[model samples]
Target: MTQPDFSQRLHGIIPPVVTPLKPDFTVDESALRRVIRHLLDSGVHGLFLLGSTSEVVFMDAPARREVLRIAVDEVAGRVPLLAGVIDPTTDRVIAHARDALAAGVDGLVVTAPFYTRTSQAEIAEHFRAIRVAVDLPIMAYDIPVCVNVKLERSTLKQLRREGLIEGLKDSSGDDTNFRLLARECAEDPDFRLFTGSELMVDTAFLVGAHGCVPGLGNVDPAAYVALYDAAMREDWTEARRLQERLIRVFNIVFQGTPRTSAGASGVGGFKTALKLLGIIEHHHMHRPNLPLNDEETVRVAEILRAEGLLPAQERKLVPGV
Candidate 1:
């Protein structure tokens, strides 16, 4: 089979579209479609569904597919849609990959197998197995915080060289390390490198990283799109300004900490902001992962207000909401 090439379209602000939920914690397709519409309307470059922002690990197989199905249908190729086939083992990821392929995703975002540590070689083979079972463009998702293993720079380069993965989503939160990798691959324009550093989008683009997968983009996609636009124009000052403002907006993720899991706080704050913006109906999170309380929801709104995302004294939907 001829391998697909997605490196070109995968660049820019590809926010991990969060899985909007119901009071029952089921996937809310209607709200999800609305979220997709909102993102496209904001001129986002791409949509990453069933990602960490979508609570992929916490969802069942059916729910994961449902989110992918909704995203693929709603996006309809307007912007590239990348699906996360994340799981604990190669076979599990392959199963998710098959479902993602069947759902018609433009590409797949995979991680090293987690919960059972393996060597770098084993990780390479994990990605190889998925590509063999399901032919499609793949992006390595390097999120060591969740997976407990870093997809080393050397390993990733080898994968790209072998054409096993066409791009990378570096959520390792180590921009210094990523900086070197980005510089090394500066000549390979097709090997897309997107940083998940919610706070340093300007630095990412400044260092030759191709794009961003900011979780905060769920709350403010247009801001990120603007940041990317600025960086592309080489307007470092504007890019820095946008990134600095975004740093304040990122405070929402902290509102739920100490009271909830880091995952819950980050994702819940996003869901709450979406709810406040009227993009989604509810901010409900999956079980064992508590949703933000009324107090935290109010604080999220306050952050949005401070960031100019909402009217300072009023509570009304934003332009895109």
Candidate 2:
């Protein structure tokens, strides 16, 4: 397959797709394909697999491999497939990277080493080692909340200067650092900068971000695609309007339901919303993470109905009725 021109094709709304699972905790392949089709048909720019939204941390090796394999096959080179190699160390991440590449992912998304405190120097070395191990394009995933180590501006600038990474997905939620990175990398046409913050996509665009990898995009991709288009057209008013609506949809991420704890709510909310929309078969969370119970599922349906995502008829069949 021909490589996508990352400089152009990589920019826009790319959803970090959820891993659809069966009750037995195995990947539900057909449902996974259906979700992919929904996103693609909704005009998403790309597909990101096995990221935080994908429950990568909870998936075993075989499950992760299957997710990547199915995503690559289902995507079929229509859009770039970015597979996450988020592990606790260099070697483990490299192993995932190798598998992702073998499964035909166009690039790899890697985060800083977790489960141990790491220095900026160590993080830089971690990315460097991965670059040496894999020939695929690399995008630094700077989600400090999950990874613990923020990819410092100086470190990223140095890596960019050395051509060690082709892109960055900043989920750090630190706008100051994100703007600094954007300004420093502005001149490089190939250096893509993506924000994973659903709430701040419009802000990211104004400050030179190329696109977004919003987890919320998994639930309502067309909204994000519209926002990106508006931003690209420099229509701030339209972009802001779309973003505000999207923020409303994003509220489902933290429904404050009793069935879901705050820690698990985001993923649980996404999976439940997908199931309610009929985009996937089930909303089963990966092991150790609880799925949204019946009450929470009904709450998700109501939110979808409020957002015009669900038909009125379906909305009437509320949970516990």
Candidate 3:
């Protein structure tokens, strides 16, 4: 398996893959491999495991390790593999980072410490410590919503200047901050700036973003790949058209509304859609995270049908129907 050249920049669509689970809540290796194959066939640029979409915060160490190992083996170096080292402290994150690197991942994706409030200086030290402890490339995961700490522009610039991080996956949803960081980082040809926003991929690209890590890419990777290609070709019209279509399909994330929480809605939606596409066998999320109910499953099926994702003959076939 040939690894990606970390010396070069990483760009294009990388899906934060959902971790498929069995009825007993164990990692479903077969279904996971199927999902990986489906994404690869769809022409995704890379695989991101143990991300928020993967429910890493809720999963234990064993489950996370299993997911990373399976992804590395299935991917076989066809593209770069980024495994999330999401923890509340530096030591714990370093532990996961070591495990992921040993499992053959090409890079590590880390977020600011959660569960405990951290100052900007402490956050910088967190990343600096990880970079010192690990030998692989590190990509900063800026998810302020979950981590409760924003990676400020000055901090990011400092990190980049000091070579503490090679890239960023900004899911902060702050357009102004994103653009500022993108503008400042534009001078470094090797600094990868990836938007975790599926809805704003075109806007991000237009402003010099290098790539995207969309959760929706797990469902329709070809669409994202097409969008990235169009953007790369500088065809804003075509890119916008494709992005709008994807946004419509992204509505499935809201299907659990008025009943389930947003997190449950998103995970259940993506897993159910995968099952409908016959890419995975089960749509079960991990324990404590609710799956879509009977009625919600029907709604998901309808959404897929309207989006032309379900086969005409199987339009009437709902899960457990």
For model 1, state the Cα shift of residue 39 in Å: 0.6
lDDT of 2 by residue, 193-289 (tens): 9999999999999999988999989899999999999999999999999998888888787764455566478988888888888778788887677
| Candidate 1 structure quality by residue, lDDT tens digits, 1-321 | 134347767789999999988878898889999988888999999988888998988898999988888888888878888889999999999999999999998889999999998999999999999999998889899999999999999999999888899888999989899999988998888889999889988998998988999899988999999999999999999999999999999999989989999989999899989999888988888889888887777788998988889887867433322
Instruction: Report model 1's TM-score to 2 decimal places.
Output: 0.96
TM-score of 3: 0.96
Model 3: how far is 4 from its true place, Å? 9.6
Runs in model 1 with CA error above 4 Å?
A: 1-5, 316-321
Estimate the TM-score of every prediction.
Answer: 0.96, 0.95, 0.96
Error of 1 at 4 (Å): 6.5
Worst 10 residues of 1 by lDDT: 312-321
Each prediction's whole-model lDDT (CA) = 0.89, 0.87, 0.88
Cα RMSD, model 2: 1.9
Q: In model 2, which runs have C-alpha deviations exceeding 4 angstroms?
A: 1-4, 256-259, 316-321
Q: How far off is residue 42 in model 1, in Å?
A: 0.5
Cα error, residue 145 of model 3, in Å, equals 0.9
Summarize candidate 3's per-residue lDDT along 1-321 as a digit string, tens digits.
Answer: 221366363789999999998888889999999999999999998888999999998888899999988988899989888999999999999999999978989899989998999998999999999989988888899998898889988888888788888889999999889998888777786888999998999999999988999999999999999999999999999999999999898888998876878988997899989987888878887767788877788778887788888865655555462
Residue 306 lDDT, candidate 3, scale 0-100: 81
